[model samples]
Target: MTQPGIDAADAASPRRIRIRTCVATRERHSDEKLLRVVVDPEDFTGRRLLADPKRRLPGRGAWITPQLSALETAEKRRAFPRALRLSTAVDTGHVRTYLAELADGPDIVRKTEH
Candidate 1:
């Protein structure tokens, strides 16, 4: 059952990806280029932050530039708690380590500036 004017190909094709703003850089990028951070539920020691690369985690999540520098800047500015809308202290060490590992991976493309 196809619509009158809509092509079957178009319907079968993937939907457009929604853009997300980097909380650190305030720049808009595709969701894939941004890393989503969420509070670590298992870390009862404190409010620890973890990267949700798959973006399938529950609860409030904050998006940041996937680059390590941007993550560091966000940490310096204390953006996580405010971005996550939580008063509890947020730890970004895990997120930093994750981004660092990704940046060092051979399969990940490193963006270059002209």
Candidate 2:
């Protein structure tokens, strides 16, 4: 039975969780701080792929920009596991591989040709 005045359609919609990830950039002022990424995906493909920023990975998610410097900073600061709230250490190689795939994306390669 539906509640009085409450729309059934609205109740059926899945609830969304938003997670924010901060990534550092190469630029001194603009990229030095943190890059905030919002995770709103219902699946892990997006977060796992790193190619699409729409879908987020399952469990706790961490955000870091597609820059070597930023990745280094995160590693040095132990930001990945911290963001994920996991006491166990996360593999840096995994993050590197993910970013490598993103860097090899069509857009990035195209921009490099110029």
TM-score, candidate 2, is 0.46
lDDT of 2 by residue, 1-114 (tens): 677887899668846654444534323332223333322245343332122244334444456666666778977886765565656655565456656766677553334555
Per-residue lDDT, model 2, residue 5, is 81
Ten residues in sequence with the least summed lDDT for candidate 2: 43-52
Off by over 4 Å in 2: 1-54, 105-114
> Which whole-number lDDT from 0 to 100 does residue 6 have in model 2?
75
- Model 2 residue 89 lDDT? 53
Candidate 1: segments with Cα more than 4 A from true spot = 1-9, 12-14, 107-114
* Highest-scoring model, lDDT: 1
Write one digit per residue (lDDT tens) for candidate 1, span 11-74: 7884899898888888999988889999887877548888999998777888998899898788
Q: What is the Cα-based lDDT of residue 52 in candidate 2?
A: 29
